[model samples]
Target chain A: MGTRQRIVVAGGSLAGHSAVTELVGLVPEAEIVWVTGEPHKTYSKPALSKEFMQARNELAELTLPDVAGDRPRGLRILRGRSCVSLDASGRAVTLDDGERIDFDQLLVATGAAARMPGMLRGVDGVFPLRTLDDAVAIRARLADRPKVAVVGGGLIGCELAASVRAFGLDVTIVERLDTLLDRPFGGALGSYFLDLHRANGVELVMGAMVERVALEEGRVAGVHLADGTEIAAGLVLVGAGSEPCTQWLDGSGLQVGDGVLCDAHLATSSPGIFAAGDVARWTNPIYGLRMRVEHWTNASAQGRAAARNMVALATGRQDLRKAFADVPYFWSDQYGQKIQMVGWHEGHDRVELDRSGDVPGPLARFYRNGRLIAAAGVNAPRVVMRLRRQIEDEARAAEAA
Target chain B: MKIIVDRQRCDGNGVCMGIAPEVFDVDDDLYLHVAETIPEDPELRARVRQSITSCPILALKLVEE
Candidate 1:
């Protein structure tokens, strides 16, 4: 056994790429192999939903760090290689190409795949956006000025529906819930957002269940609502939700719940192995809960934290510590209004609307559990900024006081 | 030196343009952009580097040449 360690990073996305960057800084002497399922260089996931939809070749503009400098001495980046399974007992991985690699430390940041519902199967032109390929396909369909139908009126779906309209394509959004952004935003804010989308020429069909998808010539032609009415669409994009990509670890003996279960340090039950990004089910001591976040902020920070801990384990360094709790912050842009959200406003007992700011702009709706738990705003970047710092500081003060 | 934006952390506030006018600007979608990478000019490089540090969202990073 040598002090020089080999670290294997599977899945090259935001979290995987961040781990590569931080590991190089943390363990400069260690050998790191970065494997990605995507053929091109690692890019931002958030852009795949919106900006890339609006422009061509925008994915090429999203390259990060460019860690593979001349010779690429410490890091070896392999594209188009997918890991089939992990052998925790042997600390080895079996690639889809039948290549075997052993590692002293393993970080699984495979993230999640866009979950396609079973009922929507055998329906052509009904797609879910996740990877660059998904974005490219959707972009091509929109270019034809097709009448598009989007299911799941959450952040991504709403943004895409709006983008399609901006590109001069007819758009309609079908949401199962009573309002748009049901889980993330409350009734008032969701209503405001729905109106905004409608004002911009997007048709909103709320509380509608998609019974089945209609296909013609092996391509999606329309979606049949539960009400027995068929809504025609040249293509259907179902952004219902996502599930963690943990099928590779099917019998690996790691504790698997909604995601790969990890302790406070983001470590898997197995030794010498850790997980981060959207796939890791992190336990938050601050809220006394365990959850998986698919946001970029969470993925980036968790990647860096996981890397530091990996280096600590490899070098036998005791000073490096882990365990992080962040006040969940996310942002979305639609109808030319920048919407920012801060904190977890789940199960709020009350909602306070502050319309003191400009009408239809710069409004803040606070969700309170006696005090304040979270806030959602429309065109209110200033309020969102202040609330983020305030909520974080308040959480710290509560811990101390 | 060069500046980097963590596209994840970036809220497209466009405040970076206010700090360093020569190097940074906001695109049509309100996202931040770097007009040029200061590869040779040390003086302009230092200012762009400083703006990266002062970015509120911690979205910017500086790469030294």
Candidate 2:
């Protein structure tokens, strides 16, 4: 056999971990070096909000099954090491400790970091739920179900509120937008969620910007809004959003926008280096648009696609390369209801309630320029499934046209 | 192939039903059930396997009959 090539993967989250697994399966003889900033192995980040808060498993149940288990002979994981710089010209990376490692192929799946508001930057009890450690820290700070104030009414914020409320704690959700989940689900579903949270005893503070975090003895006492209203709370969680983890590649000369811009094949600006997951902003050929998705399903699919492309490039079989395109799918659990969405609904001109027949929730469909673009449903799983297939079919027809 | 679902692990996310409607169904009560105990054909068997793997919670599993 010829000399094996070394493949270095940065960020041991779902995306990087999935890439390493795919690489091992695709090219068994390749030498794999996995670099992760965290100490533990890959775990289900989605489970952090859904499971970690309600029950105190300490993240034992959230770990991804066998991601860091037995290796495939040439696989080595460098845990607790972060990539500080990338030398694209030299095809290498400098770790936080200044150790430079050369690679035949590099996959940057650094994922994203939780976005914290400027006012609450150094405030204690202001937690962002992104990693296992974040979840653990938040849980440790919650003592005896103190009043919990969650900033941002997005998916993570709502889910976290729902999970913590299940512990019989008084929870409040503060959102800057007029309605919750309006960007993706639109007004109808957003109002529905507003009602759901209210019905479940969750206080909603909408259309108000948080001015600053109230501090008492160097800890979070509550949040003060711009309108001079203050909500008292013992703990605060800021789930505003997430930004791509690409600051380490500042001078790498790669096309960095909201994320690392990549082609349809998940290849970055630099050759032999690819990106996947939330950090990868690629133009999806299927949707005929560019988007950077933070969904778990997208991360898994992109990770596998990036790994296959890397293997093809290394084996000198460029002809066998495939484009990365999958319909985006995500699910959030809140208030005993399962919210599922398939396809992109942004910029849709019309949204219609397709079904509301006492199925506990409604199924909504979004259309753009007379073309079905997306669909979302609450507790109507089968309808959402059928709509996803329809969206896939429509996307294929559009691609063909 | 025989289909099995771990009810404790299944959160009724509907991922399985979305992948294979013939084999899995999530009711309005947010409960997952096997619509078809056995896949009628080879194509359906493939889809059931896909559903099993697509389940985010890893609640669904396939067993050889």
Candidate 3:
């Protein structure tokens, strides 16, 4: 037949792997190349925060199942090699080792990098939990039960703190925000996490900035807060946040805001090039805004959707292309409780908590213009599931209307 | 179809319970328990298979009898 289409996918996280899996299923004849910066195969990134800390056992425990066994015949995986630059017009990418790989279609799923505060750079006994190596190093460091200071009250920081505390280590969460998880769950639900952590014996330092990481003999001794308070610690974990890995595409003429901009179909500004996962800021028709979601479920769903769209555009079956419109869902496990959230409620005007009288579990629903936009719950999996289905049904009805 | 759960692999994430509440249950202690051994109904079988596929930890498996 005609020349085989070459598809190059950057990044080897869940999103990139999912895209490759989808492409192999959609177009078996196409040649696929997966370029990953890490040497290891795709593993569960979320497990690094959830399970890895508790048990420092084999890496296989956290590894992702072998989805590559069913890959297409012409698949090539380049591990430990990162895409350094992109040439959209020529449909080519330059790797870090000075090798150029050409592609008929490209998918950028570079994901994101952990945001480390400037003061903690190059300090000993300080780590940012992102990759497999980071997890292993942190686990090794915990063997001594050293006092640990977590420099954020977000999901990762809270989870890490709780897991470390389970090991009986003295842990303190230093947060700049007034309440934990406020950005996602707002004040009411954020307080729930606050109480959870407090009950678990994890100390919380609220609304205080870490002025600098105190160093002792080139190693971390503690942290000095902006309010002139010093907290003693032997180990520090920075989980401030993460930034989209889009530095490689700086010179490329793609629309780059906080992430590579894409339309509702997850297609980038340049034709035949698309982005997904945390690296893509795409228009969500359901939310009526451009957003970049870093949740695992959203990444997997977006990867598949982007792959389908890429296949349609490349094979000239544009009519078969579908819009990427999956509800964002993510769950965080901390202190034997499952905190789950579905959909977005960032701009919601009101929130209502439906709690069974004096019961431990409560379902919080966010409403925007009298419409249910999102729902979050603590230890309420069944209610969250029903609410998710209800939100999806409403969206479908709205679309039909 | 018979559903099997590897207790060693299950993280008690409750994803399966959300996907197939009838077949899977996650208690307050975060212990995931299978409500039925064999899904006699076709709809329940489909949901069990869906939960097996959706489980992030791959703790659930379907075995053909």
State which candidate has the highest DockQ.
2
DockQ preference between candidates 2 and 3, better one: 2
Enumerate clash totals for all models, in the order shown: 1, 0, 0
- Pairs that collide in candidate 1 are A124-A220
After TM-score superposition, the amount by which residue B3's alpha carbon in candidate 3 deviates from its true location, in angstroms, is 4.6
The TM-score-based order of candidates, best leading, equals: 2, 3, 1
Q: Write the per-residue lDDT of candidate 1 for residues A1-401, one digit (tens) a residue.
A: 46668899998987887778778767778889888878877776676676677773365556654653433567887788988899999898889899998888899999999888897765667778888788888887777788999999987798788778778788889999878977766555876887788889998899999998888888888999999989999989888889999999999888889899988888899988999999999886545468788877677667877888887777778666667676666677686687767767666677777777553364554555455667777665555656665776767776687
Write candidate 3's Cα lDDT for B1-65 as tens digits. 77788888786677666657787877655678787565478757755764665566667777778
Tens digits of lDDT, candidate 2, A1-401: 13779899999987887788778877878888899888887877887888777773446556665543476788888998999999998888999999998898999999999998788787788899998888888887775567999999998899999998888899999999989987656565877888889999999999998999888999889999999999998899988899999999999878899999999999999999999999999988868888999988788778878998998898977854899877788989887788988888887899888554755577788898888888888877777777788888888898788
The deviation in Å at residue B6 for candidate 2 is 2.2
Poorly placed runs, candidate 1 (over 4 Å): A1-3, A68-71, A186-188, A358-371, B1-65
| Candidate 1 chain A weakest lDDT stretch, 10 residues | A359-368
Each candidate structure's TM-score, on Cα atoms with residue i matched to residue i, is 0.86, 0.92, 0.92
Q: What is the C-alpha lDDT of each candidate?
A: 0.76, 0.83, 0.84
Question: Candidate 2's error at A132, in angstroms?
Answer: 0.9
TM-score of chain A of 2: 0.96
lDDT value, candidate 1, whole model: 0.76
lDDT of 2 at A172: 91
Native contact fraction of candidate 2? 0.49
Model 1 lDDT, residue B42, Cα: 60
